[model samples]
Target: MATKEFKLPDVGEGVAEGELVNWLVSPGDTVTEDQPVAEVETDKALVEVPSPYDGTVKELLAEEGEMVPVGDVIITFEVGEEAPEGGSEEAEAGTEAEAEAESESEAAPAEESAESAESAESAESAAPAPGSGRVFAPPSARRLARELGVDIGAVQGSGQSGRITEADVREHAESGGGEASESAGPKDVEVGTRPSATTKRGEESASAAAGGAEEGGAAPSGVEAAGRDRTLAAPATRRVAEEEGVDVDDVPTDELREGEAFVDEAQVRQYADAVKRAKAAEAEAATEAEPSGAEPSAAESGAESGAAAESGAEPETIPYRGVRRTIGEQMQQSKYTAPHVTHHDTATIDDLVETRTELKERAAERDVKLTYLPFVLKAVVAALKEHRHLNSELREDDDEIVLKSEYNVGIAVATDAGLMVPVVDDVDQKGLLEIAAEVNDLASRARDRSLSREEMQGGTFTVTNFGAVGGEYATPIINYPETAILGLGAIEKRPAVKEVDDGGFMDDDGPSEQVVPAHTLPLSLSIDHRVVDGADAARFTNRVIELLENPQLLLLE
Candidate 1:
């Protein structure tokens, strides 16, 4: 039977790795295409990774509860064989062949490497090294060569498929490999410094010589190495190791060839998890061993604990994991990435409250629960139309401001797990009732942990009503990528001066103003200062207030 390996796939945008929550299948079990084989938790949400092949499971490469990077082989499958799949006898034969091939491919024979070294030196002539024309190398290798004052384009590649490895560049530099004329007065390439035009052409010519074929695109057997000790791993493996702050060499592996370990993301993840668990165990032991005051009876201790809890002397500890960790990371990123400026204002929303009261029965007739959120959503969308900058994202990398034509507002919902912002798409196209229904549905699902990842994504802007829980105003962090967030405070009745039309119930005898109760709504607007100024923020707030105060204008929308 031919065996195939399955690698973890990227489940979300920019997700480099995920925690393997559980495995749905076991060894020798048959699984078909599109069948979920594993559940993974990324920074956003829980994702199920489905199988891509129809075959019998041969082995699970990764342990559960480990964080596996994208493109790491998590499992292996055996298929197209009638022989019984159980026991090591059959598995041993299959794995042995696989291991042998892996060893040979990773480390070449010493004699062959020496021969390759000699061939590389001999190939260097007045023109250039034969394989040096198109030296495929990583940016780090190029940077190293430049720092060492070596001509990268003149060095022969000694990596798999003729890709110029970093070791190859260093070796070429030590051997003083370069044109005699250029080597006499070589220039150092500093970091972030641009290379000369002639050097740029040389680098381009070297790449062009291979007809622009992708690096490592050629057959592995076609290339030769020169006794270079390099780690054999995919890019994803290296990326994960870097992200976890672990050296790839430190990761232990049983698949050894020539005393060299072939490291992948799974090995790195296992090492990282072991380190974390060790730290946690050490901390727990320390806490337990610490002596307390004279031990009390069980009843007394319980009463003491209860008193401590009631007096707020002891605080409850909550482990930050899963959704809580996700929220923390996102909040940290947003707070640090954006320079936030907050504008606070309050509007007399007596008109809005009256209009909502008027529409309550009409909305109930259609079996819809209408609230102030729909009016707020519609007003926000209308205001966004007038002030587009608040409804846009700053793409600093592309040096462009993205103004969204469609309104997709995210409503932040507080839940037991954490805060979740579910986006309501095409808000401008939906009526008040439709928007209210969607908001209710999204919030309900969010609280119950039934909201999908997609439902929480693609928000052009965000609206957080902290008023529901009794907050007047807050400086909410910009919800990343998006430039702004609007916070609605609690609505309350306050005394205000009003002009008397008939002068019938005024304290003054004739033509007087009166202090009367009016509904007031407080608003807090926070925006990214890099893309928006104070003036723009004020104008946006004004527009939203205008739309709410003049609820009749919403009919035209």
Candidate 2:
């Protein structure tokens, strides 16, 4: 047998360390090469490490939840007979033997045993029961057993071949003797009988603090304790509540006590309404507290209002340590370095809509549904080909511009967590239906956060659809490194001019001719002025509108 050390590998863009999220193997377990042995979470994504060699696990050098640097030895394997050795195996074995001997010698005295009567009694006390041998149990299960005063030796472990687990303890407790609930009741009863002097003093101090806070016109101290209850919720749940203006503390906890599992949607809405009312009341009170006086000067009032706003606002502090941090730095670099200008336009899409409707029916036969995004993407790509500057990037160091031949378009998709742009590569070569399918797949992956770093990188341009949210026009910020970004607004039907036969304005009946209104889509194009002038931007915008207005032109190379 021989030993081999497996070190952590670089898994991200220059990541130096990763936190060990989980270990899939234990000591003495046999593993095959390329089998996942551990999961490590870096700043970018969760990565799984595969076993480099097929062998029996000798030891795990790093514990789960511990952060290990790249190139550090994380696990050791005991190689089998078929394993290859590069050097003299005997010499390595001799060195390992000496080290093990030294370690054992150092540990022997601390674990020394005796055979006398007192020693025998101690040995007996430490020994296992008649039929039960040493049992493997998790720390949580052991803690639960101790709390419940349950003898682990008497309880049969039902987890993975008699190993004790948290679930086992919970099951036992639910069966009326395992641990949690049963232990809690008796512990509380016992605590009620004999209150500790320290607890009494703490209670007294808390009461005094609460009184002092109230007297000083500050919020009561108990309010802080109550606020801790809100911290127990998941971040997404908290965010939903905050967005809807819900006060979590005011929500009824009866469901939680009854073990109803999840927070009901109706309860969340009710709490949100309550929070809104409370905020309204607070704002009213603040307004009433203002002193009556002659109006101050505009500048002075503005300054005072700004100061008040700053004082009342809570600063949002986020640790710069993940994908979001990377995005933030990149966006800041792009915004400050690039000089941006925007142009807006509207296009009548009555023919385009009709074409889309016809294409959608045909597309369903091929298991693809035509969407407006694909048409828009195709139009953008076509326009980019005509306006080459839009597909170019500027170099700051040499003061040179490089025009890219490939058209990689990034579609901005909004998610519950934040915004993510997943790139669609070589859009110029892809058809409208193909682009739509790819856009759907990328957007889905983005929302699920399953997109790879490569899928998000190398975008030459970006498109953000504010139309879904009912926005008519918006000055969108250019996605950093990309020279321009296009914003799509909501499409609405409105009256438009139509051609009549025989070059006449009215029908043959002498009554005024009429036509159904067309759907108009609004577009806002934001460009980097450093790379493109207003005239170029206007021309590009006009080209994009031209393609959109005439859908047939979008299919052009």
Candidate 3:
């Protein structure tokens, strides 16, 4: 029986890693294709990972509560010698990926990496160096590389798609960077951690095998130290490099991995610093024959700009991974992409208080725990119908504004893990009680971290009641994609002008106003200014306030 290692597959919704909540199967247990083998809790929700092949479990690679990145191997199984009958397509894909990887590896030995988990060990000894094929390592591995002063590019990946783990870096450094670094040529190729690319300009290859590959017989291997127009880096790293005006393809390092480079933000920053320092130092040396006392030295100025020269205090640390990290990234995206404007207003809700008071008795009889949210949800939907732009998405890609006919509102719920927005679909079609029940259930599940991704998706607009935690008039960020968000403040009794007559009527004949204590609800509406005008926002808020002030009008709909 051949052993098959199962790497954690991408679970969907752009989730890259997950916390292994629990393992359903143990070693020596039987599992089949499509059988639930483990439960992984991603940044979104808890998910059951199913096995892809029929096999008896030989080993469990991960422990409970351990965080595993995507494409990292988490389990091993003993399976039949050949691919199962139903999984030929999967087997073929794996074979094709391996062939492609081998072709790439043969062309460039410094960039040894595996495309799939299978290629990670498939007779890889022939071309195996000391780096990862994917170069898709954890932050810890990259940190280790920096600390050890190792050129991560010169280190070969041995993980899924040639992932370089922390252990890989340590092993490579201890073994003096093994064969890959030795053949990496003149540029500080000995590995471990060599700072400054010019440290080892003319090093020799370890074996005649590498020397023979060159027609010159004994020429340095630095000619092709660069990859064949290919590099591995995370999306965020790429973005950082782009913003910093660094060409990701041109970033240089002293060492080479499987003949390729695994670039990170730190490396990109280092490359930028090195280039600036070199240029500045060259210019200064050419211009000034002696040290000038007026300005600082070029090397000192370069070091000032580089973060490597700074020091900081040690503090209690927490791993900014999983859901919190995901939430932060999304919030950052929304904040940066949209220009937000908030309009705040207050509505006298004395009638709303009386209506809810009366409805409370009826709702109690029906065994429903009624709240103001249902009414607010209904009012917002009604207001959205009049102003379609309020319930829309800005499709920047298509260069169009999509006004959605469906009124699905997402209620932001704060949970212990992170913030969750559970959407209530078709609010226009559902009654107040139906909407209330759905909201209650959604909130209950959201707090418990049981809401599925579907339940949290497809929102045209969002409602956040910050008043529950005691806040008035907040400018909330837009939910993104969605053009607007409605923020509700605390409902309190405040002194307000009340219109009255001799007959004790409100907003009636006499048209006279008097001071009185009235229940008031503050509304804060935040909109994407790019898609909406200030006047449009005011009209929407006025309509919602009007409906809330006269709660009986809800029955007319």
- Give all candidates' CA lDDT scores: 0.64, 0.60, 0.65
lDDT ranking from best candidate downward: 3, 1, 2
> Where in model 2 is the C-alpha error above 4 Å?
1-5, 19-32, 41-45, 53-68, 74-319, 415-418, 448-452, 469-471, 492-518
Off by over 4 Å in 1: 1-10, 20-39, 48-66, 69-323, 450-452, 500-512
lDDT of 3 at 367: 65
Candidate 3 TM-score versus the reference = 0.54
* RMSD of each predicted structure: 26.8, 18.7, 20.8
Q: Which candidate should be chosen as best, given lDDT against the real structure?
A: 3
Residue 328 lDDT in model 2? 71
Tens-digit per-residue lDDT, 262-305, candidate 1: 45555555554444334344444544665786455675556445
Q: Please give the lDDT score at residue 5 for candidate 2.
A: 80
Clashing pairs in 1: none
Candidate 1 lDDT: 0.64
Among all windows of 10 consecutive residues in model 1, the one with the lowest summed lDDT is: 105-114
CA shift of 354, model 1, Å? 2.8
